[model samples]
Target chain A: MLILHCPYCGVYAEETELHAGGEAHLKRATIGDSDEAFEEYLFMRENKKGVHLERWRHANGCGKWFLCARDTATLEVYGTYPAQTTEPPADIVAAITAKHPGWSWKEKA
Target chain B: MSNAVSALNGQEAKGDVTVRELGLTGMITLRGDFEDENFGAALSQITGAGVPDVRHFVQAGDFTVLWMSPDELLVILPYEKAAETVAAFDAALKGTHFLAVNVSDARALISISGDFANEVLAKLSPVDMSADRFTAGMVRRTRLAQVAAAFWMLPDGSYNLMCFRSVADYAFGLLSTSAKAGKVGAI
Candidate 1:
């Protein structure tokens, strides 16, 4: 029973009240993109066991989609942010870096 | 007009608590920038209640303003006044980026009252129904069993709940069943 905070509604919603949207910050492959690129965009995902970023919808509460960063093994939530943001906020990134040094998403240090 | 009917036609059930269907209540869905001066003034002028803070509601005379989300509000009033209220919004907020529509017929209202009203609701919702955590003036939008619903505590310790009209019978049944299951004795 994972409890996550909804950044939009400011409510700590249980997993039952939310819908998981898998990976976060996905860049869709356009029409002219290569088949491999399109396949990577559609199917490939990071199977990180430590820090992970994911999308979640507060389906039963505010009905807003948001992003979450958490540890897959320890279930320690890094933070939650609005979906409109392109990347995790500086404070959230700093928090993640503090706990897991040299950690980066998509090779962006 | 006269032919309009409520979802359950004013049905009610009795148990440890009373679950009564409040027939034909008026509701309006309003979405806009809460920070806009015109938005706040127009809402206060029409509803006679200030814009409520997050997760809260304010009542004045026959009107209640509920904060549904960051940019949405639910205005509850007498059923007969819905159309006029919507027109009033158009008149007051002519150039503002706002939306106010009559939703009176699309939803159903229910009231659960008695000593164990909170206990009855606690069985279905994931919200903290404890008196200290959820008190008067606060509104919570949550799932009631399998359906989406919103509820708030009244001044007299009762709760007024609302859900889509299509599930009125189901909501009534759920409420009554929870009321009959007896109290949990733990807050």
Candidate 2:
């Protein structure tokens, strides 16, 4: 079992713990485009052989959104990074400290 | 007055929310890499509770499996067996590639029984608690109010939920509201 590190949830399983959200770099087709254009964008498939990036949900872990890259054939994951990262997004430490003015975050884990 | 009687009478006073006062049971958090055979052996030796090969659980007397993650699991034992199980686990897992944490103080096991238990659970948890999906000897590690939790289905058709004691009151309140809403067609 490959331990996939979720940038937010930390390391998790490669199976049901994470969900494959499909191929990355999917861009919307321009409006007023021909049927052929839409068809090529939607129905067509590259079925790439190697080094493909995708999206995944850490359903069991931290539940944070992130991206992942892997080999389609060998199922060998290359790397994973946060998909939606923000500066102090709902900072758990700061929030807790604010709630408890006397409590020390450094002392508590 | 007895704690259980006070709780039953709905006249019990609240103490530290994180520190359980009443109507809670043993909650031991077992963290280990299941990929290790030695860990499995140590686990079996510890609580006399073997990590079942399946996704759910198979009880061994008083102990019950609560959560079986890829690398960790949470077992819910009776209050009487708490210290013994913890010590046994510590002894077996000593110097091994495993971490047995006694989180009895961290999490609370609330018994949600009676006729409206399922309806109450349906409010916060996404699990389908119908008999077919969730029967006796079944356990599900899911989310409650978007927080991680483990729900164990008992032989009596009741659900023993293991969640952080800090969130127990909030979760219970949510469940109670949902149950009442179900009765009044408020949903």
Candidate 3:
């Protein structure tokens, strides 16, 4: 079985944990003051096949949040971090909000 | 603020031993800036393991140090060891800004083992339990049947579920139903 390094609980048996998020690093482009730009940001993803950062929860462990990097192709994980330490890149955040008009970070939170 | 649990009222069920399966696991809450030299060393001395960094967990045999928040930790041990552990921890932090509380019996922990355990949990939680995504030795604070609980995946396929003792009775029903339905995985 693949070893999942939970940014929170260390490495654990994969069958008992839960995946909670995708890598939040994609950027959205502004569409010349158009709502389409915002919409694009709200409904897009890379769904890449290589190393991807994601969020996971040890649903049965200590109950904490953590980040993880994995190889979608081989299902091999590279590393992981606590969610607090893994902030979405600023550019990606701006793009996503720009693509989705009225989709400000405050609103998302 | 602490969440406390009272003894269960006089309620009975079929085959229900008079003792409300009200599982009680005492937890000591410790909060401090681990970066502080004294704090780190003191915690390690008491727990026999370094204080876990942000969002991590450190296990010293029966003692589990879970990073509950940025500066908060939950130390869990068997009830019988609570006194000794707390005393050692308290002495180590004689002059620190750390907070240690005796929360023994605050939460009830139940071990749900067997093949269908994951399936039963899936019915009530949205977490992805596929082996690669989430694994054993990990812990997460989440909800079950909309009730708050901490889920711990042990090295074995069993799940250690911890919830406030106040809801012990309610959780028992759900767990029993799931087990009877064979949702707890193969025994």
Candidate 4:
């Protein structure tokens, strides 16, 4: 069972206590955007093999959703942060870069 | 009082860990800004115990208040006092962004007490149930079997668990089966 800390409740919740919210930091492309952008928003995903940023709901725990930075290959969770913000925190990005050099997510490079 | 009978009213117990439905337990889902300066005082006016810290609880006799989230609390009181407590909260937090809802009928509170209580829970719960990790007064929102549940340890090393009313029967079955196996911390 994978254990991830919920940023809101401050508890290390197991997978059974949480629900996966899919890829994180996806920019919502509303009606005004082009068809490609809209399609990307709805279906396109990074699908990275090494590092990944995803959203998870602490469904049974605090009932709050949070973002996780981890390695898809090793299942090594770098960190988890609150989901209120539109982007990952600076420290988390740095930590990921330090562990897995040249790793990037979304538009951050 | 609610017409709901204890969920275990017709059930049989065959395990060392005793499980019984806690009937007619008054519960109020109190939602408010935890950082509000008047929040503690207003809740104290109704529930003798102040709003507990995150994942922590405070008890005043039979009345206890547990913090479920940043803005949520589960207030447990006697069924008779349920009405008065809700009224008090309404009167006190008139202009606040708060919701005091009576949820006594919507959820089932169960008491699992005994030496093997911890072991039975440990079998199904993913959270560390060892005494060193889960001490008294600490509460956790997690799954008991496939349903969402919350439980906290009592001073006497027992447990008070709460689950949705709809899943009470399923929860009881899971607890009983786990207890009957008598496996100590083997998932």
Interface RMSD of each: 0.9, 7.4, 6.0, 0.8
Using Cα atoms, each model's DockQ against the true complex is 0.73, 0.05, 0.12, 0.81
The residue-level lDDT of candidate 2 at B56 comes to 63
Which prediction has the highest DockQ against the true structure?
A: 4
Task: Tell me, by TM-score, which candidate is best.
Answer: 1
- Candidate 4 residue lDDT tens string, B59-167: 9987899989988999999977888888888889999899998888788888887777888888878888877888899998899878899999889988989999899
Weakest 10 consecutive residues of candidate 2 chain B by summed lDDT: B11-20
**lDDT: worst 10-residue window of model 3 chain A:** A100-109
Docking class of 4: high
> What number of clashing residue pairs does each candidate have, in the order they appear?
0, 0, 35, 0
* Model 3 stretches with alpha carbons more than 4 Å out: A1-93, A96-109, B1-24, B53-56, B184-187
Deviation from native of the Cα of residue B42 in model 1, angstroms? 1.1
Taking the tens digit of each residue's C-alpha lDDT, what string does model 4 give over A1-109? Answer: 5889888999988778889988998889987799998988899888888788999999988898899998889899989999987888998999999987876676542
Q: Quality of candidate 2's docking, in CAPRI categories?
A: incorrect
Task: By TM-score, rank the candidates, best first.
Answer: 1, 4, 3, 2
TM-score of chain A of each: 0.93, 0.59, 0.57, 0.92
Q: Rank the candidates by lDDT, best first.
A: 1, 4, 3, 2
Clashing pairs in 1: none
> Residue by residue across B17-113, what tens digits does model 3's lDDT show?
1112433455788888868998888777777778665544678887888776556788887766777877877888888778888776666666666
Worst 10 residues of 4 chain A by lDDT: A100-109
Greater TM-score among 2 and 4 belongs to: 4
Error of 3 at B73 (Å): 1.8
